[model samples]
Target: MSYDNILALNPRIQAHATLRSTVAKKLDKKHWKRNSDKNCFMLSQPNIYCFEFVEKLSHNIFETIH
Candidate 1:
């Protein structure tokens, strides 16, 4: 899923923003072009994978209406 999709699904997951930023930074180092892509610049495969790895993490995050 896309970053926005993930964020929309689980706004609470934003608590992990520092971790996400670290992952994005690593990705940026490997793929310079991603830095030019606004969306890609803020997210990365590792970041997405990290979220996916946690079971029910999304559902728990979005359980309440914002």
Candidate 2:
């Protein structure tokens, strides 16, 4: 079977989420850094999630593994 088909069958694989263009535009330009490809700007010194968010993510991952 194809890679996509295999991923579709896999329980762990899920659809990706994307940032809305309007929300993306609100980001500070000072943090923006041009990529070597010059196609997109990556955020430097981006805001990180809180400890609670990290804990939840770890819990979810652990649950998925088991």
Candidate 3:
């Protein structure tokens, strides 16, 4: 398949794969099982910033009944 026909996501796939391969070495050698990512967080420092921000934001959200 040519580049014109392909969506050219290999670079992204490889980037993610490389990041995954280093996760253990980079993040305390723990195998995180429960996880979900929907393009909302980047591989770089998501836990230290993005998720933590969302967590604190959600905590302040006022609960209301429908």
Q: Quick one: best lDDT, which candidate?
A: 2
Give the candidate order by descending lDDT: 2, 1, 3
Preferred candidate (TM-score higher): 1 or 2: 2
| Model 1 vs. true fold: TM | 0.18
Ranking 2 against 3 by lDDT, winner: 2
Candidate 3 residue pairs in clash (backbone atoms < 3 Å) = none
Give residue 44's error in model 3 in angstroms.
7.6
Candidate 3, residues 1-66, lDDT tens digits: the string is: 887557665544444444445656746434453565455645654467777887777777744321
TM-score leaderboard ranking: 2, 3, 1
Among all candidates shown, the one with the greatest TM-score: 2
lDDT for position 58 in model 1: 66
lDDT by residue for model 1 over 1-66, one digit each (tens)? 789888788646454444457778878776876435444432445576555656467677778545
Q: Model 2: per-residue lDDT, tens digit, 1-66?
A: 899998898687558975678656646443484534342232453335555576799999999999
Model 1 bad stretches (over 4 Å): 1-20, 33-66
Which TM-score value belongs to model 3? 0.27
Q: Which stretches in model 3 have alpha-carbon errors above 4 Å?
A: 1-39, 43-47, 62-66
What lDDT score belongs to each candidate, Candidate 1 first? 0.62, 0.64, 0.59
